[model samples]
Target: MPDPAANLASAMAGAYNAGDMERVILLAAQAGDEADEGILALRGLAEQATGRYDHAVETFRQLAHQQPEVSAYWNNLGVACRLRGDADAAEQALSTARSVAPHDAEVLYNLGLVYIQQRRWPLAREILLDAVDCSPGFVEARLQAAYACYVCADNIGQEAMLAGAVNWPAQPAEQALILAAMLSTQGDLDAALHTLARARLPATPEDERLRLRIAAQRAVLYERSNHLDLARQELKLLPLAALDALPDDASQARAEGWRAHAALAMRAGTWADAAALYRRVLALRVDAEARASAAFGLAASCDRLGRHGDAWQALDAAHAAQLEIAREVVPELLAPDSQPLQVAEVDRAAHARWRPLVAPSSRQSPVFVVGFPRSGTTLLEQMLDAHPEFRSMDERAFIHELTERMEQVGQRYPDELANLGGTEVEQLRATYYRMVGRVLPDLGQHRLVDKNPLNMLCLPMIMRLFPQARIVLCLRHPCDVLLSCSMQSFRSPAFMVLCSSLQRLARGYVTAFEQWFRQVEVFAPRVLEWRYESVVEDLDRHLTELAAFLEVADASPMARFADHARTKRFISTPSYAQVTQGIHPGAVNRWHGYREQFEPVLPLLQPMIDRLGYSR
Candidate 1:
């Protein structure tokens, strides 16, 4: 006869495989004192599969305690804890599992899942990559890695991850859809459509749902590619009624389809249709992010349809929803004290204290284009980029990166600049060059144009780094700047929170301009003030002057900057659409249309307006 313990273990294994959790637990109990590790493990797994996560955690914890060397027991414990939403405990258990069995793909995958739950996306992607490397067939780990890459905005990495995972596990259509979205976001619309075309869908119900998702993504790709009619046709095939008829489980996919339709309508300039579709999406009661996005889309539609009041109200709602979500996820960033507006009285003596120690190098210095956001910086950069001798990198945080590097060396900003030795200054300068080189590698004898509006705050640092660098300051009417900033949807949490209110926008404008004025006073001659109104009203004259400032004679190519902007594959700025359309005088004094809205903030902004020499 077979041994009783062996017989019991075999029965438990059969029950576990059959998903008979009660029978598996009963069989394990019957084994009593003779229950081996396998019997206990089966019971633990049954408890986990049946959603008795606390029971499973206790069982796995006991097993891990008894067999301290067994990685499987620790891994199971970690999985149960993760399911219970105890990321800290799960991470501890999984890390211990990894320490026991360093090469175990299951352990690595579980640890990566824990990181994902904690929102440590980079770390999650790194460990998940390791998991896939150890076990190439690990489809789940590969998918998780792709999602992490998407969150980190690593489009290339996301595409690569999905490409590697696509052939595995019967080529999941979900992964294909994600790959297409990543490609589209990276401005590779043709490749995105091709990816969707090559995706294989089986006859299963799940595959049917995936088919809808694929169609939705395809429509978005068409819209982004400026094929509005094709996008509309694709959307018509997957109508909102068809999406609504889907099962409750497909609610997310249904909502996504509606959003895609709205985006297509928006692109087609059918504002009413877009508004209706966005309203339907909102009625689905999706998550805060989706709701915020829909509200923003609705606001845009209303704005296009000449419903200013409704547009402003919708924008307010969108901002509120986004701020609520941001508060939960990144409370520190949304904190009132996070970005304190500098309103200290200008100290001429303090400004004069930090003298430029580094002399102007004979080497071609970089051009810094900075001003308040929405003040024609992108237009200027695009025009400058049109010149053959100039290569302008758009809106990079090189100054912030340099500040962080400076802090890393145990020094504060302007205060520490005075004490830095020649070698330290050169090292900091080299660090900046390395950062710049990463974005623009072949800067051989060409002038580098770095355009970041917020660099106004870091003027002292910039002046110290490159004493001869040309600083082009873009200026606009303070009211127009405030209105434009308030209307646009900024990705930065700080900007979103700050610009949400007209009062805050005015205060921020005042603070930023005060700092800028002080910096201009400190660093005269190097700073070139260029007005947005002047540029738009007299493009030819301004372009000529701008070209002259760069020591480039002909301004002919600069006048056709919009034609060049249209050819650019990627532009990471809010002015992407505006720059492509070329210079428009309509934006100059456009604030006059919303004088009623400006009345509340006029007191705060009028001083700056007059100071900037704009006729009120």
Candidate 2:
């Protein structure tokens, strides 16, 4: 007679393949003490299919323990653990499977899935790419890799993945949407629209939800392309009533629809409508980024309605939510009191060793615009950008990038600058030029304007790199600057956390300005102290002076800067809306409206206020 265990395993496999999970489990149990690895594997897979993850995990764990060298057993265990929402255990099990079968495509794919579940996008992308390379027919792994690229904002990688995925059998609608989003981000609106149109959404509820999400994303693309009317039209396709009728399980789709509507409302200056819709968005259990975005929109609505107190409270919530998300993304950099103190210390040491080069290099030196946030840097940059010969980069971290590059190459900034041989210095300078060239290419006969506000902390580094660089230090009333900073939502958690409280905002401002004053003493006469009030009150006068300082012959374009600003795209600052609308003198003393709120921080800001020539 045939072996009982062998016959039972064969029956179980046939039953499992025929979707008879119950029969598979029963046959598995009938094997009893004679149950071999094949029978146990069948039982585990049946349990997993039937949503009995606990039983599946136990079965796979026992099988893997009995046959420690079996990659399939470990892979099944990881899959079961992942199904049960135990990412840590899943990662461990999958890691073991990877080691046991280093070239196993299935094992690699499972481990990459676990990493994606853990939000380890970079590692997941690497592993998933390996899985695709090991087995080019792995459609699931390719899609997962595309998702990783989307999360990491690796547009080129995402495009490559989509190109391969399109050739796969039975292409997924989700993949099409991902391709559309990536194309939209790259400013290929026509291609995005085409990709989205080709999406084959099924009649299933899941696909319906995807369809609604695609509509929302298309609206965002239109908005980014400066077609606000078309953006609103796209959003209108998803009926508000239909979105509201979605069940709790479809909360994500509902949230997206509401957020899209709210964005249109905000753009149209319908503050009340935006406020109501954003409130609905916040009520849903959305991701942290979505919640933070809603909170920010609500704050903007409140501010426009003259609800200053409500606006501040909403802004605080938004900043806290964003900071929490930032902590998850960069735990090391989110430590309290780390960034401010680090910058202060580094700049102090760097300034101490500051020296002019023997002769300024022939390369075009960037015009550095540095100051505290909300201090009219954007205004100055936009004015300069309107000129034919000036090209401004909106709020980049060139200095920060250079410093990190120095550390990567076995050299510390400032301290290592003094020890650098001529060749090393040239190499470092070349690296800086290469970075700028990549970001702001085609700078034909135009002076480069680097316009990061927090570059106040990098003054010494700027001086060392480009000794002939013209530095414009934009100044505003300390109280106004602190108030505006506290009100605005910053992308940097370090800055957001520092300005979260009135007291901390005041103290941070003082620390930054103190550094600025010291840097001025170290590199005097090269710095132009441009006041925001002066720029607003006497635009022509200040523009003429600014032109003369930059050695430009004409200041006519500066007068019509707002007109030019409105026509420009890709404004990457909080002041984008404000600058496009033209200068508002009402922003001059906004602190007066929040005087009671400013009371806790006034003493800290008083010295800076006086030093900056602002009257109490």
Candidate 3:
């Protein structure tokens, strides 16, 4: 009997006060009810608040469609769309809202968040900055802007952005990650470790997400500083529960922790431990890339353990995984030839392309001591690292990985200076930078000494990347190299690929190294061939010559080579424990101990032995 207009108004008022949605719906739908825009908005807001996302979305979409001038309705619709994972619809709705409400701080903030999800870093940065300008106190906008800087690897921008966020009323989780990142950038390893140790975050809390991130970041920093002890300790503290919470997410904290743990073990020369960690990570997340890495680690471990069969299995797994990944993107890029690729042939092509790239960046006049496994590459690297100014990045596979990625994309050689398009070149360059950046950053003062013997195949690639990169080819008697390689039970892919016969081993080396040397002769004139015998014969003389060639001014450290070797880290190769001790001349001709065993390979290595001028 009551007037319908008054009844509707009373119903809305009661719904607003008591929050009873059924009565409001009934009253609003009654005949003769005076339904207005304000009443509709109230209904929409109530529906949204009560978790009726579908109904609320429909109501807001209709209202916005009917009254295109109402920016708030469109903005609300965008929020609903984004909540429903309809980013495309959300973007359109948000764009419309921005057109009508260009200066609205709330809408700008929302737009910035959408851009963040879309990975439009530049646009996100701009929108976030605009949001901050409109409302300087908006914490979420500033936080997202800081994250954008992180994505760009803009350390300074990250610092400035995070400084602003830290001053805001930040959640504890955010505070932990920001502090960890700042500490890491500044290279305060121990302090960062301690900070991570005391970190306390609430489980089942939103901020806890940031806490998980902080743990992972801190683990990376620890690994970088070569503090394997701390890295392993800290990684164990991460929330495994969070990984379960994100079962569908590939970038889970648990998976990252496994990688960090494996890296720590790798750095600490614990191949078995590293392999175990990699396997655990692969088990949880069967990603191709991770599987390749895991297989490689397992192979390396098995080789170190002198388990030849196990090592081969691991290597085969790695090769299969790598080939599979390569095939996905480039089916035509064939696998490395079954018959061991002649190193010289591969090197010739690699050097021609790589020389120019390496030449300009060879600031420290690096000495690359390369040869087959057990052929004294590690010893050469250690002797080189003994010199104070020459910093040795021992056996880093950055160039190999970089080249493999390039080869996957059909880029043949690094030194040839091919004229690929900007986008194609950019993709290759990005991968290379990422790979190398993983190991070296701001390596200004010291001469870079990379001794990845396997990289002997990609000397041409290295030369192209670092036209200034000096190559130091480490040579030993073929019989000596082969004998040492076979007896040592070497890691797969490195030494095991020679197929166990001293003959195969010698042939593999001859094929690989001959290709490497031939390519160098033509493509690189800055190379210095060093005999392992000469190094052990007169450590100081060889080192001084090396120091001068590498442009390392300080040769006094050569006098303390014994002391220098004692303090170095990550010596896992066969020469590890040996190089860590005083230089002994015993290994120089130890192959004589098994001369009869070396007869078969002796013939295959005759040419290299003659070329390298080694006495039989």
Candidate 1 to truth, TM: 0.79
In candidate 1, what residue range of length 10 has the lowest lDDT sum? 338-347
Name the lDDT value of residue 425 in candidate 1: 80
lDDT, candidates in the order shown: 0.78, 0.78, 0.63
lDDT of 3 at 147: 63
Instruction: Report the Cα RMSD per candidate.
Output: 5.3, 5.1, 11.0
Which RMSD does model 1 reach against the true structure? 5.3
Best by TM-score: 2
List ranges where model 3 is wrong by over 4 Å: 1-82, 87-224, 228-278, 285-296, 306-524, 530-541, 550-616
lDDT of 3 by residue, 483-537 (tens): 5555443323323334434555566777786677676676655777788777777
**Deviation (Å) of 203 in candidate 3:** 5.5
**lDDT of candidate 2 over 1-616, digit per residue (tens):** 8887778888988999899999999998898877888888899999999999999999999998999898989999999999999999999998999899988999999998888788776788889889878987787777787777666544445655665343445445777776666555443466677777778888787887888888887787666555688888898788898897788888888988888888788789899999999889889888876777788888878877888888778877887786675564445645555543346334455555644355353236888888888999999999999998898866667677677678878877656766665566667678776756755778777888999888888765676677788888899998988878876766554665576577877877888888778767766527788999888798888888998889889999877878888676546567766777677898998888788788887887888888889987
Candidates arranged by TM-score, highest first: 2, 1, 3
Model 1 residue 526 distance off true place after TM-score fit, in angstroms: 1.8
Could you tell me how far off, in angstroms, the CA of residue 590 lies in candidate 3 after the best superposition? Answer: 18
Candidate 3 has a TM-score of 0.47
Per-residue CA lDDT of candidate 1, range 347-384, in tens? Answer: 45765666457565523678889889999899999998
lDDT-wise, the better of 1 and 3 is: 1
